[model samples]
Target: MTISAEEAARRPLVSDEQIEDRVADLIGRAIKRKWWILFLDENGVQLPMIVPVDGAPLVPDEAATEHSIEGLRVIMDEIGAAEVILVWERPTGSTVTLPDRVWASSMARAARDRGIRVRAQLISHRTGVRWFAPDDYEGHLEAS
Candidate 1:
Protein backbone atom coordinates (compact mmCIF):
# COMPACT_ATOMS: atom_id res chain seq x y z
CA MET A 1 0.00 0.00 0.00
CA THR A 2 1.19 3.57 -0.80
CA ILE A 3 0.54 6.72 1.19
CA SER A 4 -1.10 9.61 -0.61
CA ALA A 5 0.23 13.21 -0.52
CA GLU A 6 -3.13 14.34 0.84
CA GLU A 7 -2.81 11.87 3.71
CA ALA A 8 0.76 12.95 4.38
CA ALA A 9 -0.40 16.53 4.71
CA ARG A 10 -2.72 15.52 7.55
CA ARG A 11 0.01 14.60 9.98
CA PRO A 12 -0.67 15.54 13.58
CA LEU A 13 0.82 18.68 15.05
CA VAL A 14 3.79 18.43 17.39
CA SER A 15 3.34 19.16 21.08
CA ASP A 16 4.54 22.50 22.39
CA GLU A 17 6.68 20.71 24.96
CA GLN A 18 8.47 18.86 22.18
CA ILE A 19 9.25 22.05 20.33
CA GLU A 20 10.39 23.76 23.54
CA ASP A 21 12.61 20.82 24.40
CA ARG A 22 14.26 20.87 20.99
CA VAL A 23 14.87 24.59 21.24
CA ALA A 24 16.37 24.12 24.69
CA ASP A 25 18.80 21.56 23.29
CA LEU A 26 19.91 23.75 20.38
CA ILE A 27 20.00 26.87 22.53
CA GLY A 28 22.14 25.03 25.05
CA ARG A 29 24.67 24.35 22.31
CA ALA A 30 24.56 27.93 21.12
CA ILE A 31 25.28 29.29 24.60
CA LYS A 32 28.19 26.93 25.11
CA ARG A 33 29.94 28.76 22.28
CA LYS A 34 30.24 31.91 24.41
CA TRP A 35 27.24 33.32 22.58
CA TRP A 36 24.63 35.26 24.49
CA ILE A 37 21.07 34.02 24.58
CA LEU A 38 18.32 36.34 25.83
CA PHE A 39 15.09 35.50 27.61
CA LEU A 40 11.82 37.40 27.76
CA ASP A 41 8.62 36.74 29.63
CA GLU A 42 5.03 37.32 28.54
CA ASN A 43 4.85 40.86 29.88
CA GLY A 44 7.85 41.93 27.79
CA VAL A 45 10.24 41.61 30.71
CA GLN A 46 13.83 40.77 29.82
CA LEU A 47 16.00 38.23 31.58
CA PRO A 48 19.56 37.17 30.81
CA MET A 49 20.49 33.55 30.53
CA ILE A 50 24.11 32.43 30.29
CA VAL A 51 24.64 29.71 27.79
CA PRO A 52 26.94 27.10 29.38
CA VAL A 53 29.79 28.72 27.46
CA ASP A 54 33.21 29.70 28.62
CA GLY A 55 35.05 32.77 27.41
CA ALA A 56 38.34 32.71 25.49
CA PRO A 57 41.58 31.82 27.24
CA LEU A 58 42.98 34.50 29.47
CA VAL A 59 45.87 36.22 27.74
CA PRO A 60 47.43 36.71 31.15
CA ASP A 61 46.18 37.44 34.64
CA GLU A 62 47.47 40.98 34.09
CA ALA A 63 45.81 41.36 30.67
CA ALA A 64 42.48 40.16 32.15
CA THR A 65 42.11 43.57 33.83
CA GLU A 66 41.37 45.14 30.43
CA HIS A 67 38.73 42.80 29.00
CA SER A 68 35.25 42.58 30.48
CA ILE A 69 32.74 40.53 28.50
CA GLU A 70 29.85 41.49 30.80
CA GLY A 71 28.46 43.58 27.98
CA LEU A 72 27.46 40.46 26.15
CA ARG A 73 24.84 39.25 28.62
CA VAL A 74 21.61 40.99 29.55
CA ILE A 75 21.14 38.74 32.58
CA MET A 76 23.69 36.95 34.73
CA ASP A 77 23.23 33.66 36.46
CA GLU A 78 24.66 30.16 36.59
CA ILE A 79 22.22 29.33 33.75
CA GLY A 80 20.25 26.81 35.79
CA ALA A 81 17.77 28.80 37.82
CA ALA A 82 14.03 29.07 37.34
CA GLU A 83 14.06 32.43 39.08
CA VAL A 84 17.23 34.25 38.04
CA ILE A 85 18.87 37.13 39.85
CA LEU A 86 20.31 39.58 37.28
CA VAL A 87 22.94 42.34 37.04
CA TRP A 88 22.94 43.24 33.37
CA GLU A 89 24.12 46.49 31.78
CA ARG A 90 22.51 48.16 28.79
CA PRO A 91 23.55 46.91 25.39
CA THR A 92 25.57 49.23 23.06
CA GLY A 93 24.37 48.06 19.69
CA SER A 94 22.37 50.42 17.48
CA THR A 95 19.46 48.09 16.87
CA VAL A 96 17.69 46.63 19.87
CA THR A 97 17.57 42.86 19.77
CA LEU A 98 14.90 40.62 21.28
CA PRO A 99 16.02 37.25 22.52
CA ASP A 100 14.07 34.15 23.49
CA ARG A 101 10.61 35.50 22.71
CA VAL A 102 9.51 32.01 21.96
CA TRP A 103 10.45 30.98 25.47
CA ALA A 104 8.51 33.93 26.80
CA SER A 105 5.46 32.93 24.86
CA SER A 106 5.71 29.46 26.31
CA MET A 107 6.30 30.88 29.76
CA ALA A 108 3.35 33.23 29.42
CA ARG A 109 1.17 30.40 28.33
CA ALA A 110 2.23 28.40 31.36
CA ALA A 111 1.89 31.33 33.72
CA ARG A 112 -1.50 32.34 32.39
CA ASP A 113 -2.65 28.81 32.77
CA ARG A 114 -1.92 29.23 36.47
CA GLY A 115 -3.70 32.63 36.45
CA ILE A 116 -0.66 34.83 36.73
CA ARG A 117 -0.02 38.24 35.18
CA VAL A 118 3.23 38.36 33.22
CA ARG A 119 5.92 40.57 31.69
CA ALA A 120 8.37 40.05 28.85
CA GLN A 121 11.86 41.25 27.78
CA LEU A 122 15.21 40.14 26.38
CA ILE A 123 17.74 38.08 28.41
CA SER A 124 21.48 37.68 27.89
CA HIS A 125 24.40 36.07 29.73
CA ARG A 126 27.59 37.55 31.17
CA THR A 127 30.73 36.32 32.86
CA GLY A 128 30.80 35.67 36.58
CA VAL A 129 33.89 36.54 38.56
CA ARG A 130 32.48 35.96 42.02
CA TRP A 131 29.86 33.46 43.05
CA PHE A 132 27.61 32.98 40.00
CA ALA A 133 27.29 36.68 39.15
CA PRO A 134 24.82 38.38 41.44
CA ASP A 135 21.25 38.39 40.11
CA ASP A 136 20.95 42.03 41.08
CA TYR A 137 18.88 43.58 38.30
CA GLU A 138 20.70 46.73 37.29
CA GLY A 139 17.68 48.60 35.96
CA HIS A 140 14.21 48.64 37.41
CA LEU A 141 12.74 49.38 33.98
CA GLU A 142 13.79 48.54 30.46
CA ALA A 143 14.67 51.63 28.38
CA SER A 144 13.47 50.24 25.11
Candidate 2:
Protein backbone atom coordinates (compact mmCIF):
# COMPACT_ATOMS: atom_id res chain seq x y z
CA MET A 1 0.00 0.00 0.00
CA THR A 2 2.95 2.31 -0.49
CA ILE A 3 2.52 5.65 -2.24
CA SER A 4 4.85 8.15 -3.81
CA ALA A 5 5.60 11.43 -2.09
CA GLU A 6 4.06 13.30 -5.00
CA GLU A 7 0.82 11.36 -4.66
CA ALA A 8 0.78 11.84 -0.90
CA ALA A 9 1.39 15.57 -1.27
CA ARG A 10 -1.70 15.92 -3.42
CA ARG A 11 -3.89 14.82 -0.51
CA PRO A 12 -4.90 17.17 2.25
CA LEU A 13 -3.78 15.93 5.66
CA VAL A 14 -5.49 18.42 7.89
CA SER A 15 -6.94 15.99 10.43
CA ASP A 16 -5.30 13.48 12.69
CA GLU A 17 -7.34 10.69 11.11
CA GLN A 18 -6.18 11.69 7.64
CA ILE A 19 -2.59 11.84 8.77
CA GLU A 20 -2.82 8.44 10.44
CA ASP A 21 -4.35 6.83 7.36
CA ARG A 22 -1.80 8.37 5.00
CA VAL A 23 1.09 7.37 7.19
CA ALA A 24 -0.21 3.84 7.44
CA ASP A 25 -0.41 3.71 3.68
CA LEU A 26 3.10 5.05 3.23
CA ILE A 27 4.75 2.90 5.86
CA GLY A 28 2.92 -0.30 4.98
CA ARG A 29 4.19 -2.65 7.70
CA ALA A 30 7.57 -1.25 8.57
CA ILE A 31 10.52 -3.59 8.35
CA LYS A 32 12.88 -1.34 10.32
CA ARG A 33 12.93 1.54 12.76
CA LYS A 34 12.72 5.02 11.27
CA TRP A 35 11.38 8.49 11.84
CA TRP A 36 9.38 10.26 9.12
CA ILE A 37 8.97 13.98 8.84
CA LEU A 38 5.97 15.32 6.96
CA PHE A 39 6.14 19.00 6.22
CA LEU A 40 2.91 20.74 5.45
CA ASP A 41 1.96 23.90 3.65
CA GLU A 42 0.01 26.69 5.33
CA ASN A 43 -3.19 25.02 4.16
CA GLY A 44 -2.24 21.67 5.71
CA VAL A 45 -1.43 20.06 2.41
CA GLN A 46 1.69 17.95 2.60
CA LEU A 47 4.86 18.99 0.77
CA PRO A 48 6.72 16.61 -1.46
CA MET A 49 9.87 16.65 0.62
CA ILE A 50 9.08 13.79 2.96
CA VAL A 51 12.12 12.84 4.99
CA PRO A 52 12.78 9.35 6.34
CA VAL A 53 15.35 9.30 9.11
CA ASP A 54 16.86 5.88 8.84
CA GLY A 55 18.67 4.12 11.72
CA ALA A 56 16.84 5.93 14.50
CA PRO A 57 17.02 4.14 17.81
CA LEU A 58 14.09 2.19 19.26
CA VAL A 59 14.58 4.42 22.26
CA PRO A 60 15.85 7.72 20.95
CA ASP A 61 18.97 9.13 22.54
CA GLU A 62 19.14 12.77 23.57
CA ALA A 63 22.07 13.75 21.35
CA ALA A 64 20.55 12.16 18.29
CA THR A 65 17.17 13.71 18.92
CA GLU A 66 18.72 17.13 19.35
CA HIS A 67 20.64 16.78 16.14
CA SER A 68 17.57 15.65 14.32
CA ILE A 69 15.60 18.59 15.60
CA GLU A 70 18.23 20.98 14.31
CA GLY A 71 18.05 19.31 10.94
CA LEU A 72 14.27 19.50 10.90
CA ARG A 73 14.37 23.20 11.65
CA VAL A 74 16.68 23.79 8.72
CA ILE A 75 14.51 21.80 6.34
CA MET A 76 11.31 23.46 7.47
CA ASP A 77 12.86 26.87 7.12
CA GLU A 78 14.20 26.12 3.69
CA ILE A 79 10.80 25.07 2.40
CA GLY A 80 8.78 27.52 4.48
CA ALA A 81 6.72 24.73 5.98
CA ALA A 82 3.92 25.84 8.27
CA GLU A 83 3.88 22.69 10.41
CA VAL A 84 5.32 19.22 10.71
CA ILE A 85 3.95 15.79 11.52
CA LEU A 86 6.31 13.22 12.92
CA VAL A 87 5.84 9.50 12.51
CA TRP A 88 7.91 6.91 14.30
CA GLU A 89 7.76 3.70 12.33
CA ARG A 90 8.85 0.54 14.05
CA PRO A 91 8.59 -3.15 13.37
CA THR A 92 6.85 -3.94 16.63
CA GLY A 93 3.43 -4.53 18.11
CA SER A 94 0.69 -1.88 18.02
CA THR A 95 0.32 -1.48 21.76
CA VAL A 96 1.97 1.69 23.00
CA THR A 97 5.03 1.24 25.19
CA LEU A 98 7.32 3.30 27.39
CA PRO A 99 9.71 3.90 24.54
CA ASP A 100 6.86 5.15 22.41
CA ARG A 101 5.84 7.60 25.09
CA VAL A 102 9.36 8.77 25.54
CA TRP A 103 9.81 9.26 21.81
CA ALA A 104 6.67 11.34 21.56
CA SER A 105 7.60 13.39 24.60
CA SER A 106 11.09 14.05 23.33
CA MET A 107 9.85 15.13 19.92
CA ALA A 108 7.24 17.49 21.40
CA ARG A 109 9.79 19.10 23.67
CA ALA A 110 12.34 19.48 20.93
CA ALA A 111 9.87 20.99 18.52
CA ARG A 112 8.66 23.40 21.18
CA ASP A 113 12.17 24.45 22.07
CA ARG A 114 12.84 25.19 18.40
CA GLY A 115 9.55 27.04 18.01
CA ILE A 116 8.44 24.53 15.40
CA ARG A 117 4.75 23.80 15.19
CA VAL A 118 4.11 20.07 15.24
CA ARG A 119 0.68 19.18 13.97
CA ALA A 120 0.86 15.66 15.35
CA GLN A 121 3.12 12.97 16.66
CA LEU A 122 2.22 9.47 15.50
CA ILE A 123 3.46 5.91 15.65
CA SER A 124 3.39 3.49 12.74
CA HIS A 125 3.73 0.04 14.22
CA ARG A 126 3.33 -3.41 12.71
CA THR A 127 -0.43 -3.04 12.67
CA GLY A 128 -1.05 0.59 11.74
CA VAL A 129 -0.45 4.25 12.41
CA ARG A 130 -2.02 6.05 15.35
CA TRP A 131 -1.68 9.35 17.15
CA PHE A 132 0.00 9.62 20.53
CA ALA A 133 -2.65 10.55 23.00
CA PRO A 134 -1.83 13.33 25.45
CA ASP A 135 -1.84 10.84 28.31
CA ASP A 136 0.65 8.70 26.46
CA TYR A 137 3.24 11.48 26.59
CA GLU A 138 2.20 13.87 29.37
CA GLY A 139 4.02 11.99 32.10
CA HIS A 140 7.24 11.90 30.13
CA LEU A 141 7.11 15.51 28.95
CA GLU A 142 9.49 16.69 31.65
CA ALA A 143 11.63 13.59 31.66
CA SER A 144 15.27 14.35 30.79
> TM-score of each candidate?
0.21, 0.87
Q: How does model 2 score by TM-score?
A: 0.87
Question: Measured by TM-score, how close is model 1 to the native structure?
Answer: 0.21
Candidate 2: where is the Cα deviation over 4 Å? 1-10, 141-144
| Regions more than 4 Å wrong, model 1 | 1-99, 125-144
User: Taking the tens digit of each residue's C-alpha lDDT, what string does model 2 give over 30-81?
Assistant: 6778888989988898887889998777787899779888999999999999
Where does candidate 2 have its weakest 10-residue lDDT segment? 135-144
| Residue 91 miss distance in model 1 (angstroms) | 12
For lDDT, the strongest prediction is 2
